[model samples]
Target chain A: MRARLILWGIAALLLIALPPLATALGQPYYVDLARRILILAIAAISLNLILGYGGLVSFGHAAYLGIGAYAVGILGFYGIANGWIHLLVAIGASALVAAAIGAVSIRASGIYFIMITLAFTQMLYYLGISLDVYGGDDGMRLKSRSQFAGLVDLRDPVAFYYVALGVMLLFVFLTYRIVNSRFGMALRAAKSNEARSRAIGFPPYPYRLAAFIIAGAMCGVAGALYANHTGYITPGLMAWHQSGEMMFMVILGGMASTAGPVLGTFALLLVEEVLKGWTEHWQVILGPLLVLSVVFFRRGLAGIFFKPDA
Target chain B: MALLFEQLLNGLQYGVMLFLMAAGLTLVFGIMNLVNLAHGSLYMVGAYLAVTATQWTGNYLLGVALGLAGTLVVGMAVEVIALRTLYERDHLDQVLATFGLILFFNELIAIVWGRAPLYSSLPPWLQGHIKLFAGSTYPVYRAAVIVVGLLVAALLWYVVTRTRLGMLIRAGASNRTMVGALGVNIKLLYTVVFGCGAALAGLAGLMAGPIYAVQPGMGELILIQVFVVIVIGGIGSIRGALVGAIIVGVVDTLGRAFLKPLLGTMIPPTAAEAAGPALASMLIYLLMAVVLAVKPAGLFANR
Candidate 1:
């Protein structure tokens, strides 16, 4: 636990300091990239809630991201500049969608669950493509960054980076609290052995569903942040590849551990950037790394670096 | 009415293609207990190889033969080099490793063939139309595809039910450890099964090359749908794959063809126009969802 604290401490210091460090180094482009990482970290953290704690491998988490993004995009096209509405619709729609998906598909275990989630995400992807009014197959550019009634300006890079950081940190704290709560323990127990937990009078469905929805809502927030960061929305955002990347982050960071997703987000995006600078086909390196990580680092980067006194 | 019949045939052809893809996926899952996401990559390879081979040999039949053989070799190589290590791992590890294989294969294809979709036309013999009924007809190639698919299906059924290889496959699916204890070469059997699955996927790909756009990511797009088929039909059953594939294909095609017109009569034009296409595409997924709700083991789950 001491190691976890120090790890969190270092992460906080870096996220807090990075924008200025980036600016001082005359690499404002990196500040933008950092913003992207923070946003993605938030999403991965949400994924960790269900996948890590509850053992529900949702291959369609990107659908929530897409739903959240398209919520913003659809609203933006209608000139709804209220930030609160964007956030609410993102969370609300994502939770509703998650609830529906969870209610129907959460009964499945293992590969069935994985495939069902994939089907849901692909459905949304096609829906996005079908929306000709929202720019259809080609994505649309936001006319303006989300407006917050002068409380904050997203058009400014540093401010946007801070907002993204603040959102991530808030969720990280929330996640820590929830995972340690009675509900989280029960959910974890259920994941480890569902029938045993049920025999012990702890129903698995509601808790798992709750975790699923909460995670979906959290990812929805990240999706909104993502739209504001990139100033656009596209169907590609919900593709399974994005979900796989997020899974890699959560896996790379370490499951059931707070701050793992943050570390993973940094590692994956950083490697991609550095490798892209070296070669156009960076996936050649990345593909092997993913396989190797699974083979060697079962507990992820967190397992390798910190044993956490277990 | 005539249009309906044609659309029904279209659905059958597409379903047959899907069955070819899903059959391999189901077999590997049932017998080997391995979830190979790279199955789609094999499909893509078949398409690419067939396109290239056709150009090289100037004979479509020979090109298809070569493509199927190439896919079998590639599949076996993948199983030996990558998947052999993964059989004992958890589904998560298997998923991640095979996902990496997908990335590697896609990039490899991009490097070799470029990112653009390849265009492969059907041979002249399979072009034109076939009369199915009075004043109703279908594409000759599609009719040929149906015939070929049925033949393959019949061949598969024969091999699985009437041969020693079929008996071994069934026994392995039922009890892998027992089969191994019975002195079967489990390793060789796995490799052969994986290769056969790849050949099926490849055959589907080569047959589809002339119809669908052959591209780097094309395999994955169809893969998810194939997953839906297996889920609806049951993961480990070939019979389930055939049934589920037909249902999905027919539902998807009929819905796309008629839903717009049907909805237009009930709703405003703008709403119908906007929602018609989305709803149409969602038909197969909806079917899968309903089927799963009713039977969690799927329609014909043997495992």
Candidate 2:
């Protein structure tokens, strides 16, 4: 337990200190890329809460990202650029959608749940494409970054990067707490054996639902950060492919481990960046790489490195 | 009213195309207990092959036939090379692998054909419109699609219901181990089954090429709709694929066609104009959610 605490402490310190150091070293682009990785890591960690812990293979998690992004773009477009307000609205909108969608989706298990979530996300994609307002298929651009009350300057890339890093660390800490808590145990038990969990006098449905909502809210924050980072939002943000990519990040990193998402996001994004630079048809290489990883490595990179307690 | 009828027909045509793709997906899932995400990639290959074949043979029909045959071969090859190993793996693994295939195929296509959309036209004989009642006209090509889709549907129904192969397929879906114990060559059967699914997807792509732009990433666009069909109709049931396809196709088409006008009547025109398209686009998802709520297994779950 002491070892675990020290590991987490080191992780937290690195998360806080790495970006400023990169900025100090005159590698602002590297810091920006790290910020992007952290943002996606935040999203993937939320996904792990339900998928890794609760065993719900949701294919539509990217829809929450899209929802959160649209919230920022739409609210900002309407002249409400307060950073806190936009973040709150984004989280609320995503949570409400998750609650409504989860109520129905959690009814089915296995492949059915995956397909249903994918279908709902596709519906959202089409909605985004068809809406004439908010730039429709072309996507809308933010005139400016969200403004804070005399404190944070989001337009500054360094400040924004730090904020993203802070948010990611907070989410990582929260996920760690939730997974180790009593509620977390119930969720893990449900994943192991639903009938056994039920026999032990714990209902899995509400616990799973709560986890799904929490995950969605967390992803919403990532979505807002993504929008701010790019200063643009499009229907493609909610596409089924995006959802698939998010799932890949979780599995690629190491499902169920706290550091898994962080590692996975960095690896996946870096590979993508490198591949895109090498050739336009990088998917040819990357796609097979993904398949090989799944077929060969049942345990992800974190699994190979950290060796979680049995 | 005539215009409405035309739109309805258009929806049916689109649904029929979707049914072709969904039928193969449902069949493979029901029989093999495998979730094939690369199913869309197969659809894409069919379109590319059709375009290539047409250029080679100068006959659209022959090109389509070759496309179907080529896709079947590729399907079997993929099953033997990649998917055969994935049957016992978790769905998460299946998803990741198949997603990889999607990327590979998309890039491969881009490398070969360039990233621009191809203009695949119909034969001169199939290009004109057929006159319906009064003076209304519908595309002759669309009529051919409906006829071909119905015929394929009938053929699939016969294969799944009356034939020995159908019986084996049904048995396999229920219990693979039992079929293996009974001395059936389960590996060969899975390959053939996956091949048939690929052929069906290929057929859908070939037919869709004329109506929708045939491009590198076309498969990904239709893949989600096919998933919706299987979800609503119940996975692994061909009959369910048909019904679900029609329902989704019609609803999506009609919603896009008249949703704004329908809302305009009930609310402020400006508000209706603003919200109609968004609501219309999401109608099918709403339908899927409601169906799942009422019947968690599906509308016609095979098991």
Candidate 3:
């Protein structure tokens, strides 16, 4: 456990030092890439809350990402670029939607759960494409980055990078706490054995639903950061494959482990970048890589650090 | 009134297409308990193969036949090479593995066929319109698609109900371990079932080529709706897939066609115009959610 903490600490320090190191190396493009990866790590970590720990395999988590992004884009469209408002609206809307979706989705389990979540996200994707006023299928560009009342200038790349890094760290810490809490224990119990959990007097429904909503809301914050990171929002962001990619990150980094998804995000994206650099048909290679990883790396990258369970 | 009638027919045609895709998916899900996201990729493969074959032979019908056979072989191969191991794994593994297949197939198609979308032209015999009633006409090709889809569904029904293989499939779905103990070649059965599912998806794909864009990721566009159909109709039941597919197809089509006009009458035209498309697109999802809320196992859950 101490070794794990030390490894995580070193990882965190490296993340903190990324911007300066990348800039000094004259590969400043990597800072921007690192920011995107950090934002996505937040998304992946949130997914880990439900998928890794709670055992709710939601295939539509990208809906929250899309919603969060659209919140910023639409708000910016109407000239409301206040960062606080963007964050609030993103979280609130995603939470409400998640609550509604979770309420219905939790009634089902296994494959049904995965499909229903995917269906809802598809519904949202269709809605996004139909919003003609908001650029519809083609998507819209954010007019400007969310304003922070002059507290932090987002226009500065370094400032924005630190902001993203800070938020990601905060979420990593937050997820760690949640997963170790009493509520987390209840959720995990229900995940392992719903009937047994119920017999033990903790019904899985409410806990599962709560975790589902919390995961969605947390992902919403990532979406807000993602929109600023890219300066664009589209229905494509909520595409099923985007959700699939996020799930892969969670699984690849190591499910149920707080730091695992962050690691997975970094690993998957970095590999993708390298492959893209090598050839245009990168997904052809990446696709098989994902398959092989899933088949062979049953425990994922983080599993290397831990002893096998009996 | 005639326009509404024609639109309803269009919905039926669309529903028939969805049924073709949904039937195979439901069968695989029921019998194998495998969630094949890459099923869409098979549909895509069928379309790509058929289009290329048609160009080679100058015979659309022959091209489709070759495409169908090719997809069946590919499907069986996939089952053997990739999906065979996944049968015992968790659904998460199945999902991610198939997702990997999707990426591979889409990119592979792009590499082979170029990223530009291809157009599949209807043969001379399949063109023109059929008069339904006074002042109403529907395209003959669409009418044929409906007929073909229904025939396949009927054939599927007959096979599932009357045939020995159908009995085994039903037996397997209900009790896989028991079937294996009973000396059935379970592995071969899974491969055949997967292949049949692939052929169905391929049929849907090849037929859809002319109507929709024959592009790399075209399968995904319809795949999600097929999931909705499967969900609404209960996962394992063929009847449920047909019913769910038709309902979704009709609701989606009618909503898109008339929602703006319907909403315009009750509200400002501009407001209706803005909200109509969005609401129409979301109509089926709302339906699915309602169904889920009321019957989480779906309307016709097999077990």
Tens-digit per-residue lDDT, B40-128, candidate 2: 88999999899899989999989999999999999999999888899998887888799988889898999999999997878899989
TM-score of chain B of 2: 0.98
Q: Once superposed on the true structure, which residue ranges of model 1 sit more than 4 Å away at CA?
A: A308-310
The pairs that clash in candidate 3 are: none
Q: How many pairs of residues collide in model 3? A: 0
Can you tell me which runs of candidate 2 are displaced by over 4 Å? A5-17, A20-25
Q: Summarize candidate 2's per-residue lDDT along A98-201 as a digit string, tens digits.
A: 99878888878899888888888888888899877889999999877778879899888778878888888889889999999999999999989999999999
Writing each residue's lDDT as its tens digit, candidate 1 over B187-268 gives 9999999999999999999888888899998899889999999999998999999999998888888999999999999999
- Each model's lDDT comes to 0.90, 0.89, 0.93
Q: Which ten residues in a row have the lowest lDDT in candidate 2 chain A?
A: A301-310
Model 1, residue pairs in steric clash: none
Sum up the clashes in candidate 2.
0
Error of 2 at A229 (Å): 1.2
Q: Could you give candidate 2's fraction of true interface contacts?
A: 0.97
Give the CAPRI rating of model 2: high
Candidates 2 and 3 compared: the better one by lDDT is 3
RMSD to the true structure for each prediction, in A, is: 1.3, 1.6, 1.2
lDDT of 1 at B201: 97
**lDDT per residue, candidate 1, A76-133, as tens digits?**
9999978899999999999999999998889888999998998988888888888889
Point to the candidate with the largest lDDT.
3
Q: Model 2 clash pairs?
A: none
